[model samples]
Target: MRLSRFVSAASAFLLTAALALTGSGPAHAAGPVYVALGDSYAAGVGSGSYDDSRGGCYRSLRAYPRLWANAHTPSGFSFTACSGADTTDVIKRQLGPLNASTTLVSITAGGNDAGFVGVMTTCLLNSSSACLRRIDRARDYIENRLPARLDALYDAIGSRAPAARVVVVGYPHFYKLGTSCIGLGASKRRAINDAADLLDTVTAKRAADHGFAFGDVRGTFAGHEICAGPAWLHNLTLPVYESYHPTASGQSGGYLPVFTAAV
Candidate 1:
């Protein structure tokens, strides 16, 4: 009887061990799963040395996501962010990588929906009055229509990855605090920066409403903007595809540190 009891006890211990190994025991048994989702900024558009496997997504090895992943070594990582992706694109294409298993998520979005590219182009190529009008239009859209869209997106993300710690990353102003060295008028420079600030403000509030952390990058890029002594952002690329995106140094130094601290 003693021997039989001992065998049964040993069998139970082995079964429990097997369950743990197979990740069927409890939450503690599962490994970390990280998912990155968003648009060009999240995809490292301006950072050189793109990953060919990701095609037009323009993901760079030196991007903040990869940097953070390298440092943490999560059990699984899915980087689905793509260049030129808007919020709608994220809802349709990017969210596929997230699920109940996701423990971490990072996103940089809403700029496209707010017509960031168009605003920048108008400001760069058009008259100051035209630029201000464009900026006002974008600002109105951000204040009036953006909040609801953001709320829905945040809700969708939360529902899909209920347990994940979501980090909403914000964009930086392109110019230094009071300097516009790229031939842009002072008012135009200030307008552009103010637009960026508004975007971040709206993004942060929406993130807070959903209980997600907003990773503000304005301070991170303070002295490294386009007009700075040693700029961290690309000025304007000939191909146009690489224009105005963060440099590799920006990703490694500016974004990585802020994201690391948030996560």
Candidate 2:
């Protein structure tokens, strides 16, 4: 038997009332509407080829946003998400274009909030112990600063698309460490997991405070994490991907379930 998954559900009332400014019912209109907001992860980097003409942010049709769009067919989607956005970027640039007609909004952010990519690169290639030592110093920042930033983001989304059900996503582990995909040690892997958990906890708490849902991709990605069972990532040993990120199948196979549950 397939194991059942736990999906946290929130009331449509909470979202609808929040966005009452947008009007209501069939009078409102038809179709599934969505506005995506976030960084490279949300933009589909490393999964497939992005539009080079659109910059290095390689958004693929298979990206979760597109998958989500397809799943919600007959609906319109406005993808304002960018590849390198931090919390501030989401608030300033991504949120404005969104409107009350939007029924769903999915976002993954805050990794860039602390230069997360740089930390990951350093840890994956350098002395894992030392790299984590540097990252640990910012644990408090993740715990505290990140929550405030997310709260600000939530507030901004409400101001624009009050009725949209917001789903904030967490980052996944990039490397598995110790198993030697890239020679990272077990301790470093734990550090990365810890970092991801910190973000998840904060995102979940803030989402609850604002009556939205938080998509916990971390749990879904377990076992298959970095250098372990299936390694959801590539580029650790490659000239292919300089930055550690998820593989295409991983994005759909592991990630989609989590998102589907939330929806």
Candidate 3:
């Protein structure tokens, strides 16, 4: 009788502990079906640990969507977000995994559509005037052309995953101004930051119009941008594609919390 009672007590304790962890820990039992969609930032280019099978998509294991999935253990997760994916790319290629069963979505795009690489290349390799001129042209595209594209992509997502809670994540300011920053000049840094702000504003508005949550990481990245000590974003790294994207810390410490709260 005593042996049976001890075994029962031990079993009850284990069950209670498991229940407590399930209730309070990061992992939830049979959580939402998540589909992550967007650009290099979403694919975790800068965060490294690339999944080679993804080819040039460069999806990283440390990316926020993956980290969130690792923690929450969603029933299903489709990470179709590709490196260098533009809005059109997303609409055409990335929407397949999303469906009526998907419960959560996150995306970061439009930078590529606005000639992110071109502008950055011009800025980093040329004079400040060159950078500003390209920025002006890009801003024109952002203000005039990107809206329709975003609408088209949003419509596609809605049609495919009508029940999903989409979170459109935006870019962060790349520099901390007013300090003597190496690499990029003050004007260049300011212009880059302004462009980031504009992109976020436009993206946020479109996401809001579609009744989606806009996860703005600008505020979260403040004081952690390049030129700030211990920056979460890389500054002109060797891989180059990794440059200007979030590090692993940013994915975990920056993007994850904002995404989690929104979800």
Candidate 4:
């Protein structure tokens, strides 16, 4: 009876151990699923060559989301960031079918609403001071509309994926400091950067209120701001065409820390 009981106890212990091992898997056994949402910034408009099939939004496979995906091997990612997307665009198009299984979510929107692209295009047409005025006007529009729109977007995302950790990424400051442009003065670039900062602040606040993370990239681009660093953010260059957006290298560096830290 003793021999039989000893064998049975050992068998039960082995079975329990096996179950525990199988149930408590690795932390990243099934890699996290990330869904990236937003406008041009998130879409990597000027970073790398975009996939033509995905539309003219210029989403590149080498974009930040892809970089994060590669670093975190086996990570599942859905890059649905489109160009010219507004707050409403994210709520209606990006959040559909998202769920608790989604691990991370990031957005870079609101610039389109301020008509930033149009203002930049106009800058090329005339004197820099005139362009600066447009930027100021755009800033006012952003201060008025961006905050409310971002809050609504966050609320909508929360409704869809309550368990997922959302992250709203802020825009980086563009233009060099203490450096005047050949045609445009330093004041013009400074104003544009200032406007970008304001937009970022609004987006960050909205993310915080919604229990989501905010990736602050404003100060990060300080020294490397447009025309400041040897080669970072593009400014009046090919592919970039304007100093407003980030270069591919800048995007990788800017995105790496945030993506790694949040995930």
Q: What are the TM-scores, per candidate, against the unseen true structure?
A: 0.88, 0.81, 0.88, 0.86
Error of 2 at 108 (Å): 0.8
* Candidate number with greatest lDDT: 3
Backbone N/Cα/C clashes per model: 0, 7, 0, 0
- Model 3, residue 234: distance off in Å is 0.8
**Least well predicted 10-residue stretch by lDDT in candidate 1:** 23-32
Q: Any runs in candidate 1 off by more than 4 Å, and if so which?
A: 1-31
Ranking by TM-score: 1, 3, 4, 2
For model 4, the superposed segments whose C-alpha errors exceed 4 Å read: 1-29, 240-243
Residue runs of model 2 more than 4 Å from their true location after superposition: 1-29, 175-181, 235-242
Between candidates 2 and 4, the one scoring higher on TM-score is 4
Tell me the deviation in Å of residue 48 in model 2: 0.8
> 1-263 in candidate 2: lDDT tens per residue?
22322221235556676667666533745776778888877777667756566665566666788777787673778777777789898888877658878788888888888667777777866897778876785577887687888888889898788888888877776655556655567787778777777777777888889998888887777777767866776646453442566677667876667777887
lDDT of predicted model 3: 0.91
TM-score of 2: 0.81
Worst 10 residues of 2 by lDDT: 1-10
Question: Cα miss at 209, model 2 (Å)?
Answer: 0.9
